[model samples]
Target: MSTATPQKFEFQAEIKQLLDIVIHSLYTEKEIFVRELVSNASDALEKLRHLQLTEKDVHDDNLPLEIAITTDDKAKTVTIQDFGLGMTREELIQNLGTIAHSGSKQFLKALGESGAKNSNLIGQFGVGFYSAFMVAKSVKVYSHSWRKDAPGHVWSSDGSGSYEIEEVDGQRRGAKIVVELKDECAEFAQDWKLKEILTRYSAFVGFPITLNGEKITTVQALWLRNKSEIKDEEYTEFYKFQAHAHDAPRYRLHFNADAPLTINALVFVPQENTEKLGFARLEPSVALYCRKVLIDAQPKDLLPEWLRFLKGVIDSEDLPLNISRETMQDKALLDKLGKVITKRFLKLLEEESAQRADAYNEFYAQFGIFLKEGAALDFTHKDQLVKLLRWESSLTEKGKTTSLADYVSRLKDGQKEIYYLVAPNREAIESGPYLEGFKARNLEVLFCYEAVDEYVFNNVREFDGKKFLSADHSDVKLEDVPQQGEALSEADVKDLTKWLKDALGAQVAEVKSSDRLVGSPALATNADKFASPMMRRMMKAMKKPGEADEPVKVNLEINPRHAVIKKLHALRAADADKAELVAEQLLDNALIAAGLLEDPSRMVARLNKLLESV
Candidate 1:
């Protein structure tokens, strides 16, 4: 202890209000105190680094530029020491005691004038040091100024109303904060617990970090480095460390941009989609950083919701954070960053698709749902997202995929629309009546198998100026297949169609002799222009129990050359009773093929009745 007089002061009214808010409601997580103190320590070290470059002398020139944290659970205390710029007796009074010198007066005044409008100014004040009271019963800061003549001092506070500063002897060249943990916060005094928090929130801090004399932040902040200089192994290690993932990254984008905003991003596409494995919905994992110091580990708006699968670090020097450094304050700036990152990732995907087809295909196989989502919902990048979409079409092999661009390349000379059909699988699609006309005309129909594909296509509507049409839609018009064999005469078909419509009654909107069906006797096409079989299923699944099923109205088209239609037509001319049963059976069969049959039991009973009659 030194024989110097002590200085004591009460906190300003604004600081008292600010402190009350910080202690009660500012940070949702109590663990943020570690990040706040570490950041302050880092700033102090940075000040000393700058001082050495410009000033004539720095006290203790041989001290290492690092931060060390020690924990003593038995003593219920944790201490964080740094060997950088330290505070003198006067600084201990000014920096820790009086609010007039703490740079928070301007921040409070700004907040008072702007009311709720200027909350973004909180981060510029550097008041993160005051967050220590959230978990501490009391805090003692011991520091020695970098100036040779300045005496060391200790600042003590319980964070209730006032603080004390006194001269101290034999202090080192940096600040050491000793926190007496409250009973509820005693977990922070354990070595393992402190290490975990440090790893999560402060791992990439520019200065070295150590716990209990062991270094913790071993990996470099690769996002800030030159992309070419980073090694493959380094990237893999960083990915595993940052994402807590086991498998290596399948793809990564390390880039820096300056124009829209200063951005340094290192994003990685994981080897697999965790959400695809039945895990809970993934939260945003891209950590936000400023000058290599973490601002947030899971920022909600850093990227679009469709990009939740990505994991890595994004360091933006332009981010304006709140005083807690836990959330972003500027929504517009965050949106701009999101746009830039999203566009870059999309451009990378395009290049990957061109350069590594097999790898890109594998990625699409696992995570294509997100791209489809972006295509449907993100208008600004809908065209790019659509380009990345893959599908199995008539031109591609069974398991292979094709893009819209490839589909366009294979289009017939005069084709004006892109056609697709939604079904359970390729086999179901091939056996359906909708594909017969397109197949006979040598036209390719893209197969959409996912439940959401219908919704996606409806929102996307068109791509490359070509409208997307559902092959099973009632309004789809196909050119007549060239004459192949003897067919029913026009008068015979006209009579047969009128009689069929009367027999089907309310089941169908229209009955006609089909030009679209090749081999099928009859097919049901949905009358609802916007709804497909898959969309109907989705709506039904989402409906509440006992809700009435949506009415299924379809257009029934008959193929004149098919054996079943010929038999039904001749039977109708002779036995009217049996012919009615055959006509109903034919309509049920068409409904089954169209996946519009809500009750298969009725179809089963009708089939048995027909069998008994035969």
Candidate 2:
């Protein structure tokens, strides 16, 4: 009920400028107005809570500390009311008429200067309230001051240039904002739309919130709560609610840190990796929040790209957000926060691997590719990510894995390089010529079965001071092992290599007698120092059709002690034509074993020719 004639006043010049930005460009999403208003409501509620501790005389003392949002499609209006610290007529003018006089901005400045009073109020720039003009055709604020002596007032604005204020009676203790939405933005007046925006941005606000008399904020901000008091079932429920997950998480990291930056994080590793199930690339699921209000639901810069599979919440009180709160103003601070989180997660993994080996192994089996991705691309956390990677080696039985640190621990005396072989599977590696020499010399070779393994190792390069060396690489030189059988003389080997080199021409980069071959007569290794055989095959596969591929040339290493090499050495002089066909067929066979043969047409023809000579 109005008690006096309305007094109209022109908006302060700075506020008019700010209103234009808020209405036209300050925010990318128009629905952000709801988030801004709700945050302000939360802040007001917090102030009233503090006032209750000191002041005995207050208006609307019986009102609960909560927020109520009501939307009416028929009227095309949204009403949001908070029973918190309301404003007097002069306070309203000071807080709303001028941009610089924002109570929240002053509070923030005081917090900055006084070293953080124990408050979680999030309105920092004081410009959030103006965001309502984005959708509102007319706005009205009804407020009653907390002091019993102060009178209630209603402020009205069309956000054009001027506004009116009227003294009113029977007003509540806090503020109630009614937004008469524009015709084009009438969708915001729907209950469903408002509910969605509220649930997304304000679900975890400290105070209770209700929409049309029904409770909206049911889930607590579990990340901010102490971990010791949280039960496992509560965690599972929160995970299900936040992640929209059906299966319980395999691992969860809940931690709070104060140094460098204040952070509260709850991250989860799902029981299954959906990206591995042939789904589209996972988007960043770890939402970014400030003081429990969502800043970005899928903030690309909050976490490294490799952590896209992780799903949960990361809330920080230390964020310095812009007026709109859509983006962070300081990228360096965000990066520091991300680093802290990544390191903490890796530490959790380390502890899990040490204390619960079986569970960690199971998690690794499901999500190891993501760690490999991080190890390859994210240099800042690569060392920690590398330590968390797991692989099955020659010494380990199938289905069992060992970490890079464990492999380093078991390094043979005088072993200077960590050896690994990339193949399609353990069976392919065990049956191939690459592992024969290492196995015979009692050296362990890690079995890498994924396509990304070689690329990851290439990027990682080394771990624990030992460089990673591919077993099938051309330049790899293994220490001398005592011979078990008769071998070709040095002179005989030189002659055979010269003849084979000439016979194979451009196909063979070089031909030499090998110390790294035990049973196989010959094997092909890529002569290119930059790319492995597997990497070359992958590159060829990815190349566009009709694009010419570079010729495949390999260094052919022949086992001098094998009967096939000795027979080929003799046959070259006896039957020149037959020896040429045998040599070509041998190179094809080696290429097939290395998974480098894209077409076997020439090999098929040469096999028939060899059969005819026999």
Candidate 3:
């Protein structure tokens, strides 16, 4: 130690400016000071570790590279110590008293320009240390250089305008910072408070960390580890910790990519979708990290909203963070990073569906809505998401599902469209009149039961070069199947259709003998190509009750060979009133089957009149 008076120096203009910005306006949370100081310590230790490799004459070579934190509530002070590359008197003045000579700033510029993926270096801005002044009344740095010939020094500052530095004795070859907390900021000196901050932001730091002599950084950074080296239990444990979940994850995707952006991601699909259980909407749980230090825990723009069900960590070295690291600086680069993660996740789902059909089906049963949402919304990843969609089909058992790729592979020769039908359930679809034609022709039709099914198909439109066609759509033209039983004459068929159109009035858009009806007497198809029956019903339900519905008109298609049509043909002239009543009843029945019937009052009265006539 030097037996001399302490040398006081005026603070550099830039250092004063930097302190004001950091303490007053830069950080959103005052607790961020803990993360910044700990990060700086870790960076110092990393530098020392590197020096150990090449330098033979190192000071304090036997001290372990670790960080220790102590909090004294009675004294209202917090002390953080690290056995790292401490600074000499001149270096301290350059690094702390002046912003221009900051060591971390130069390292950041050099690392960035070199495009190096040094995961260990996190101190990009050299001013992270000044964040302590946010909650500090005073800060003292006790440091000794790693060089054997250098003497120890202590720098003191109240962060007002100037600082004093003087030599000290018996100092270790590292830096120890003691922050005398302000009266209002005494919370930082509590054991529990510091523990919470350290676990959240510094749990994944490379070096060991202790809070009041107890190890707090116990959770490993599994995302940066090799996937093959990780075990199922380890991944499950990480999922539970990261997601704050009770149940094990249903699926986990751990991968690293260098292209497009250097990424280390570990994403998981939860055991169930809480949103589906009628809970509040889910938020994005996939936290964004850089170099193993968390940047944003719930970054909204990190993933698409539909993928809110996923939970995990995504750490990338390529992110360009602003000075505070509270938010990302480059939104375009952030978007690219998200796309990379999303594409990888969708690919994982595809692989799961192909290799583990039963398990994947179970996952789909719970999480399929997310995929459907992505398919219907996100255009960039829609093509990949479409391959993961599943639905029940006529060719599969009641509970079994088929993928679009599987359906396309099974398509009949020369077919150019994939057909689907939305109904209340499998039984409703199988028994409905619309499916009779497809079943009769031995063609498969996907059965969709969810309310969003129609909307999804409407947006997806096509897949694998084949257009999506609703089985009951008015524009649908199915190839003819062999006719069975006696058929009505063409003249009689024309007469019945014409009478039906006139007798039903505005209820019928057009009446025609059907090519798409078999084993069923008749069916109704939407006249508006854009509005399917299910979609119209959904829209109508969303409106206030008793709100008059928009006028609905459907094209009624009748099977000419069915006995009811033949009898109607004979009875139309025999009794015109009875025939008119029967025609109205037939239209009502078709509307009910199509899910387009808004009111049945007129049909109820007409039905009673027909019964009395009988």
Candidate 4:
């Protein structure tokens, strides 16, 4: 009798193209191949785990269900073996030799037809097995079916064009992938490299991953576990491991959602905000996962950029497991997932701020810029994010913060606007002429220190029907203060105002007797309708050419009752030139107080002239 063997077959045309993409351009990092193979092994073990729950006649049930990776640097080969549900000879031929059975054919067809410029689809398409060819010169997969009656088999392929499946003896119940590493790719066979890759990409995998006989995935997938079961210490450890942060988490949210999407998330706000230390704006560090398998370590669009300070894991089971499993096939679903998580996170923050004021304040001080950013840019959740913002206000002591809701609650019965002033510090704002009028009227003004606060407030025009108005805005009209100590007669005020306007010329848009100035001699208001001191500084910092010396007109308001202005009016009539110099000096001093002076060099020279006259 002639012993004839089954025939080997060449790869399909689409499979060849798919292989080329997988081996060359599919994944940004080549180390992902280890993660892919380990993930596949974990899935096989998971299947057996489910099978063990119901099935009684399981083959080799005595063997522990785990993935073991053995590397041989000398031989330039790495073997990933899993003692779980293996495949029969026919199953091997169908799963490895053919493209249709592996479900990769449809993915490749989609890739070719869609012509999507970004190839983030490869990992999500379920062809992660082919990622082996990225570093392997040749691969041999030895598998045996879990059925006691099924025979063992070996599938060998160089991934050039063809593959062979032959019956092999003494194979284990699960699959084992043996990759002969290319000359330049042998670093994967080193124990240290494999362990690092496993820790980074697959540390939280449900199944145990062993590298060179030592288990590497010691940390559990806390996001997948019941929140009640996870201890605080475990959470801290996970945060440290995932976020690479030294300090413990200031706040954490462990939540699961089923309606919008099946999501399991464990998110953390670190104890310190690194960006607050003037580090670069943080990129989104939330690791994206599907069923405990990592999809993207840092997905740019997974969450809004404002939530970049958040660190942790988000896992969704609804995600389709594609070939590479590095990205998602359905973008709409991913976006929905992102929105759901973001909303839930925002809700959690609201709760934290309410329940733990001191802790929340610490977190807010470090990470509040992100909330301000969201308020300015992310329109979908702007209202909710705005509510979470806290600022130093006249109602609160220095370094203390009050929320917009609190600010609204403290508003007087007839107050129509929410007032805020952007300044360098609380002391600066308190000592400025703008706050004097507000303080006289007992009106609260929010103190903003960050440059972005002005932009944020502009975008958030109103909150809860109260318009946000800058305290220093020229358009602000304040209640008239009854003459308390002294008064400038209507004629004297009119004469002084006329003389000041003529003396200041174009530098003063319209000098007038002030209703807002309390003790100060004068105050400068921005003449440009759309620009404030903060806005001007932001524009200058952006280095828009020819913008530094951009002329900004100002409306100067002089306190008619102040001694300096009263004496200056008399000095102007007696000595016109000296009064003009004194008037100019007073205007420049107000501009400096308003943070509107672009160049102080001229002010210093003018001061020297005044000193000589003195």
The residue ranges of model 4 lying beyond 4 angstroms of the native Cα positions read 1-7, 12-14, 112-126, 544-548
lDDT of 1 by residue, 1-614 (tens): 86588777797777788788789988988888888788788888988899999987888889999999999999899899988889877667666655656656655564444322333333321377778899999999988989988878888889998888888888889999999999999999998898888887777777888899998965688988997898999999999988998879999999999988989999999988878899999899998887766777888987999999999999887776556666555678889998999999999999999999999999999899999988888888998999999999977889999999988888888888899999989999998888989999999999989977887889998888888889988778887668566678888889899999999899889998888888888898888865567788888888999999878878899988888888888998688988888888899889889888878887787778888887
Worst 10 residues of 3 by lDDT: 111-120
Q: What is the lDDT of residue 73 in candidate 3?
A: 99
List, in order, the clash count of every candidate structure.
0, 0, 0, 12
Q: Relative to the true structure, how large is the alpha-carbon lDDT of every model?
A: 0.84, 0.87, 0.86, 0.83
Tens digit per residue, CA lDDT, model 3, 1-614:
65558999998776776677778887899999899888889888999999999999988999999999999999999999999999998888988897556643433453345432333235732457888999999999999999999989999999998999999999999899999999999999999999999989887889999989998855789999998899999999999899998889998888999997889999999998888899999988999988777898989998988889999999988876644567455678888888888888888888888899999999999999988998899888889888899999999998999999999999999899999998889988887899989988889999999878777888999999999998888888989889887889998899889889889888888999999988878889988855677788777879897898788878999999998888888898899888888788788788888888878888788777887876
* Candidate 3 positional error at 569, Å: 2.7
Query: TM-score for every candidate vs. truth?
Result: 0.94, 0.95, 0.92, 0.93
**CA shift at 542, candidate 1, in angstroms?**
0.9
As for lDDT, the candidate ahead, 1 or 3, is 3
**Root-mean-square deviation of candidate 2:** 3.0
Deviation (Å) of 313 in candidate 2: 1.1
Cα lDDT tens digits, model 2, 71-128, are 9999999999999898889878887886556644433344345433323225732458
List candidate 1 stretches off by more than 4 Å. 54-56, 99-101, 109-126
- How many Å off is the CA of 471 in candidate 1? 0.8
